[model samples]
Target chain A: MTQTSLTLCCKVLCVESDDDKPLASPADSLALIAQERANLERDLTPDPRWMFWPWGFAWLLGFGLFFLRFGPDGRVFVDLPEWLPLTVLSLSFIAAGLITGIAGGRSAMQTRGPSSRQGLMYGLTWSIAFTGMGILFAQYGDALPDDRLGLLWAGGMVALTGALHMAGGAIWNDRQLFILGAWTSVINVAGILVGPGWHSLIVALGGGLGMILAGLLGWLRLR
Target chain B: MSDGTELDPVIHAQARLRVVSALSVLREEDKVTFPRLQESLRMTAGNLSVHLRKLEDAGYVEVTKTHQGRTPATFVRLTRRGRLAFEEYQEALRALLNPTSPSTSSEETL
Candidate 1:
């Protein structure tokens, strides 16, 4: 139907509440059903988390880690100690975690469908899987070359993140998130094939751009 | 004649039907705020209040008025009775729409 017609139908449907009025014609009933379905679709759309503060910090974390790993011309840009980047990365994660926890807690209090506990479970699972992978890599570090080790780490992180996103998206039935997860998964495989030297760059450019774009889209939607 | 008559008049009205339909999709404990419901239904505050009062009077919906800091917020959720009434209304509507169908007779027996 034309937008004008739909709006007129919706307006009619919204205004008619009198019990004394004649029963709605089949066409009118159909229109009301259509309008109701549209409203439900609009309402059930998930909150725009990409616009949240933690997401912005997540982008920073990706870029910061990339810069730390590659460095500028083999020299640190800020000439900081080797441990400083790790410290910064850890701090960013803590900040993101805190923000997510606060936001999720507030959201859970307001809405009953999306449970904060479910989100915490997802996060805990990811952390455990990541730590297990790290231990395995450490144990096999001597068997692999230094360059290949970096590739494995980067690829593993990307794959893990993509898998989690895909899982969450599937559970929530969010198409945007599912597509993002698929895009990241594709990029992860492609980055690994390029080998170590360029893997970080690919991830930084691809993943960072993806996140920024998603954030911008979410912001626009909110506006 | 009884087919259409079986429908719940409280839910059969378009505005109230929309309200109950929206609330039905939400989790049982979830509450929709007044502004959100108004926007979704594209109705004026006064008009929504009237319909909400009717539903509240019928014991189909529970309306809560509370303060968020300095601002007052109105939240609404369907009661269990409300959900059941909505389901029965839907069944009656289907029967009315398909009076000649065998399935309608089977549904009516249930």
Candidate 2:
């Protein structure tokens, strides 16, 4: 933007030539630009907290049921059918995926342009990442005892999710997203260390509630 | 690049100034659709087209036309020089607001 390049005038008022007066005072112009810049920032990045709600609830309900069914000592507390805990986990994750997908897709459509493309790619990356994890786990999983097998599955999935969340945060430059990822990793490690039954309980309470808290914080900041 | 002493007319005009300000907020690699820009600024296509042409001629903005699937889309972004100019313009505005004050800008000279 060369100084000499500008030749326009509202009736020839622009430039160092100073033939015309500005509609906005210099102070007002600065303020207007500041306001406009903030507006663009808001539009470009809508509040992302809404995406976290489904995931939070899914983890809470799913893991809570797991904790109740498989207790801290691996003894059956609720006496649910053998298929119930795993089914609950599977269904909860699927539901979360569907809900977040719909919400993210709607946001992408509204934001449109590069953001939508980025969102699609990001969503695909999650699928590929989790699929890779599932395949890897299947290969070596049978060697572990039943209790260890459950821990391995839960721990591995939670760890992968944390890593992906961190990646997402870095890509978006979102502090909350990055912090949530970090927190998830910490709680996941804690759950694994406490053994199978305790792992379920920790993840159910910590991992599940952590996401909800993060979402709540985002809501507060937005308000 | 300006020394924060004089405002650049390229961005001093009202509408173009707003356009440049809006663009400066984006990440450097990001490009916005022409319709999005127009809608955000609430300007008519003809009006935006005219200012964009001026900004383009001044090397302040880059416009690209590409296809999103089967539909053609036009995108716009500020050039690096354009970003520098906008920053300098802000500094110039700051100085204009308080004229007898000592200029603290690195670009200012004794």
User: Docking quality tier of candidate 2?
Assistant: acceptable
lDDT of 2 by residue, A1-223 (tens): 2332221121122234332444445677898898678666555554546578778877888777777787777677788877788898898899888877877765554334456688789899999989988998898766988778888888998998898889989987988888889989999999998888888888878888888888788767654
lDDT of 1 by residue, B39-69 (tens): 7888899998999999999999999988778
lDDT of 1 at B14: 78
Q: List the residue pairs that clash in candidate 2.
A: A13-A20
Ten-residue segment with the worst summed lDDT in candidate 2 chain A?
Answer: A4-13
For model 1, state the Cα shift of residue B9 in Å. 0.7
Q: Score the docking of each candidate (DockQ).
A: 0.17, 0.26
lDDT of 2 at B49: 95
Q: A-chain TM-score per prediction? A: 0.63, 0.78
Give candidate 2 misplaced runs (Cα > 4 Å): A1-23, A75-82, A98-124, A140-142, A170-173, A219-223, B1-6, B44-46, B98-110
lDDT of 1: 0.65
DockQ value for model 1? 0.17
Task: Find the candidate with the highest DockQ and give its number.
Answer: 2
